[model samples]
Target: MSSVDVTTVGRGPGLVVLPGATRRARHYGAMATALSEMYTVHVVERRGRGRSPAQDSSYCLDAEISDALEVLTETGSKQIFGHSYGGLIALHVALRTDLDRVIAYEPGVSIGNTMPRSWMPRYEQLLAEGKDARAMVHFLHTCEFMPGGALVTAMVWAMQRFAAEGRATRELLPTVVRELHEIYALDSDGSRYGAITAPVLLLGGGRSPAYIKQMLPLLVDVIPNAKLVVTPEFDHNAPDLGHPAAVADLIRA
Candidate 1:
């Protein structure tokens, strides 16, 4: 049985939903609720967050893959809907298991040197200094998630320290660096993904980072049975926050 804390809702064939870095299972409540009408939704809290245990010193891509597979095995989930880093995990799982379908939303797959790294130094330094809020701003700014100028970022960071969710999110801030590093560690050209046998849908946002959107079609070209769809209505955080119901519609399609 997987030690992972999976939020189960609805009933029918299962669809495991893997959250992105800096995300807990509950972050998927809305999406899971929407998909619940059609399928049993298992929103898994990847190891290191919620009730799940942390990854050991030897943790790597295999560790994440193992955690995800355990949930799949325990849930008998034949389909998966992975967002952000979770999308990256789903693609890896597709290589190991014959899933019914794989829906990846802005998957964090780093083909060659495409994944951005210029902000790592500052973000990691800020984290090392115990300055998580600053690190978040840097991440958001660099990843194009939070757009504005320095004054706006500074103002937002100042306000974040007062919000409950912001404070809660601070606890998972380190996981961002850790998970992104994992992405970097496993970075590769699209060659390995070509073997994924399941039918794949690469969903993207019209407003996400240029790099993220650019990776979609390339992935569609690589994954044998994959196609691309860019939802002009949503951004990178759509599945988790903005428009989860619409994202569920994509998954349902």
Candidate 2:
């Protein structure tokens, strides 16, 4: 909570963004640039990537919340947007703090063991053995991408070795494991989210994983002052990777 890495942009009311697991501050460069004209966007480089301190022995979701609170307090910002796992953190932060608005972009909220944990054992063992690329296979398998058979696995392995995503995903395999654990540990039936006081916007990608799509509707129903918005032209990684400009448009709307 002391000195976290944050990439700041723009000149208006501050809006903090938390990237999903394995994503770095620079991964959101395009999004930050798109939103800069309207809002001072502070894209946090969450722990373990970039210049931020690595996740230690006791890292957990609570630790993530503490770091986010520091960003909000330091910037005097009350608005937040979290992508994927970051969305989950942003929502939980609102549960414990006051905020003017909260936007969760396809949050990885696990409803009653919906976020699969079966891949953990093999993934962890491969990571411990220094087989990071191999470990990525197990995690990607859990993603349940339709028709993601041998070709997808082959691409995952090749990406680890050749693609620039090697660092963004393959190299950060260790952190992804930890983040997934946090998701699984918080599994519930969406009841507890009723405590969030801020008016919420549950942003989702129409083309994202089916489980992700399923989770958002239940979230809208539980949060007292929340609404659901889906962008059909987008997917799970749109905010940082593909549709930042359009996503920014939604944030200001």
Candidate 3:
């Protein structure tokens, strides 16, 4: 098994965490810490970020699932929470592994043409033009399910500014793009998930995009042991860094 570093916190039964496209385990510190009060939270840093090793010559979703499985094995964790793309990974892991419970917050699973294929070229163009921040912003504008309006524009502008001021966002751009591509490549047919017997908590933010809301019902219908929870005020990032305490509460409940 591949050796991966995990950030552990709190105490009790083991709980493994997989972050989304950010891939940075530390971003979920607040949520992990809160969960730690009830369970030993093991935050796994996705490959190509934090202390985890860089991506190999070939990158595939299976590698990511393997990484999570390795961590779960190492920690003896049977419960997991996956945010965003990480949620997608967790669902797959639950199907293949012996997990008691799984929580997926907006797994980014696209059905048919849910993913905006037309934006790829413009995103790549911005990246190639040395406008990494703009590329990130453009990507967000294209994918985020929330209402774009001025709020999104402001958010994108702020993200661009933040990316310009710091190296973290810029450094993570390539990884984000790569993972997004992988997500798009995934088989969107929800039928495969019917095989997952473990109890699943299908979570979505009320403020998240309509597509995400649409996905929850599909997942719940397909996964016989699944239920849905919608946090009306939270968006896609709630479980990661937005509302850690609330998310922790859900996990604990």
Candidate 4:
């Protein structure tokens, strides 16, 4: 297997953070910094992003879990925090291994076809047409959070600026598409998660879509040691977005 890139920040007990579909560990700078104050933060740059090698044909959810396991073993971090698709990966890891604690923020587990089956094809078409920005916009719109008009408009503007500035959000499109496919392909039942023995803190956002919010209860009911917490003031990207401090406080608590 290819080597995974792990970046360390702060000082204290080991804490590994797995970012969402964005797969950009650097984007979690604020949250890592905050958590670093209380724990040594090890951020894993998922394959196809940052310093991690690009994904090959063999890439799959198992590969992601393996990458995470390697990081956990290398860092000896028993505590993990995962957001979005990363959360699903973390949960899977906990199910198969013994982890002290897990804190997941809106894992992209589908329950009752939470994701529209038509989205993948539409997103692929946009990518084929070289409309990466539009593809991202559409992807966000379809997300469980269903970002509103203002947020969507702002994201479009930001994406446009990034493209103009040569930062090109388009570069990350393939990884985004692949991860979305992975999420959609997953079966929604929490029955398998019942085997996880680690204590879990399932978090969601009040402003997030009903589907996203609904996962917390199902997860809590299935995972014997799980609890749910909703941060009413934030949405899906709480840690990397506006409420890193709030999220950090929760982690610390």
Candidate 5:
């Protein structure tokens, strides 16, 4: 918690954002730009990304959540928005900390009985072997689901294309692969949400994976003071595609 560097925008109460493991704070530039105009936005760079500290070994969700809390304390912002794995961290923060409010955008921690039981260990092995492309492809085909099969296929294709150039993809790939263990370690049985007293906005994309849809209602049941926001026009990655103004307005409300 000592001297964690933060990239701030605007000037007001803190509104810290935690990006997905594969994305850096810079990737949320569009959202930060808009949110900054209204409230001071602190985009957490996450450990090991950019100038942040280097992650020398394995990672855990608790550690990631602690990093987010560090940002919150550093910026003094109780309002937080977490996307994907970031959302999972936000949820943990709400459960474990005194964050004024939180917005979790489509966290994929729930696999239920639908997921292939073998995928986790296999992914771990691939990651250990340094076969990231193969690992990512495996994750997409099995665990990278986002509701509709067609859309998942398209998104996976795009990600694969981007990942084809190893150098271009190296920056985030290690984090993504290394953090898989942490993400899977999350317990989404709804027990953790009972501790959250803040007004939580659970945002989901209609076109997201069926598992995501299945998990949404569960979140409502667990988070004491929470509401649902389903956006049919956007998918899991929509927040990065200019949805922050709308999101900021929701937070402001």
Candidate 6:
């Protein structure tokens, strides 16, 4: 496994930020800049992206959490912010470590039974057949569940941009494909996260689609000391741009 490269800025308490799947720490540049005003922001560069090393292909979620722990231990920071898959990693970290507080933005696909068990396998097949964009479509569809309107058009536009930019073929591809099975294989008993005692801030976009919309309540039920923040006018990318200030408020809160 590769070690995460942490960039420190500002003063006060320490706050480590973990990005979602397929995105890099720089993707959180705006939030990092905002958070840097009050806290020492350590933007974690997860394996296979940024300055981190390439993933071993046999890696699992536990390994990813270990990496975050290593960053926390080295940085001596107890506060963490995880977005999407990173949120899931943060949730698992909270269960294992003694963090002061954690902010998780939409963790699980199975949290609301929105993803089918066979999805990952089909994605794997598509990848093997060199249908990388098709595979991406499947994953995106699962998250967005596009409706027949502007949302659908937006989804299409995003997918086109993603493909044109070779987003799926980036440094995170191999690891994303290999570890997806690990995510799919996780048992949906919900009891696994019941042990987490850290205060969690659950942030979800009101316009993020039905599947992600469904994740909010499910997460509230699973986490003991958690508060939900629903950004009504935003979607997944809301954290990136549409509502950076709002997201910063949540991080700083």
Candidate lDDT (C-alpha), each: 0.87, 0.86, 0.81, 0.81, 0.71, 0.73
Better of 1 and 5 by lDDT: 1
> Residue 43 deviation, candidate 6, in Å?
1.2
**Worst 10-residue lDDT window, candidate 5:** 108-117
**Candidate 5 lDDT tens digits, 42-69:** 8888777767776677556767777877
Worst 10 residues of 3 by lDDT: 145-154
- Best-first order by TM-score: 1, 2, 4, 3, 6, 5
Query: Backbone collision count in every prediction?
Result: 0, 0, 1, 0, 5, 0
Regarding TM-score, does 4 or 5 come out ahead? Answer: 4
All-Cα superposition RMSD per candidate: 1.4, 1.8, 2.6, 2.6, 3.9, 3.6
Give a tens-digit lDDT track for model 2, residues 1-253: 4468998989899999999987888888988898899889999988898788789888999988999999999998899999999999999999989999999999989886667678789888988997776677667667753334567667777877888777567657788878998899899998999999999999998888888888888889999999999989888889888888888888889
RMSD (Cα, Å) of model 3: 2.6
Question: How does candidate 6 fare on TM-score?
Answer: 0.84
TM-score of each: 0.95, 0.93, 0.90, 0.91, 0.81, 0.84
Q: Candidate 5: list runs displaced more than 4 Å.
A: 1-4, 111-117, 122-131, 144-168, 242-246
Best prediction by lDDT: 1
For 1-253, candidate 4 gives per-residue lDDT tens digits of 3377877999888998888876478768889998887899998888887678787776788888988888888888899999988899999999878998999988878766765556678878988987666677777677544553657756775766665432434567788777777877786676888899999998888887777877678778999999889989878888888698888888888
The alpha-carbon lDDT assigned to residue 247 of candidate 6 equals: 89
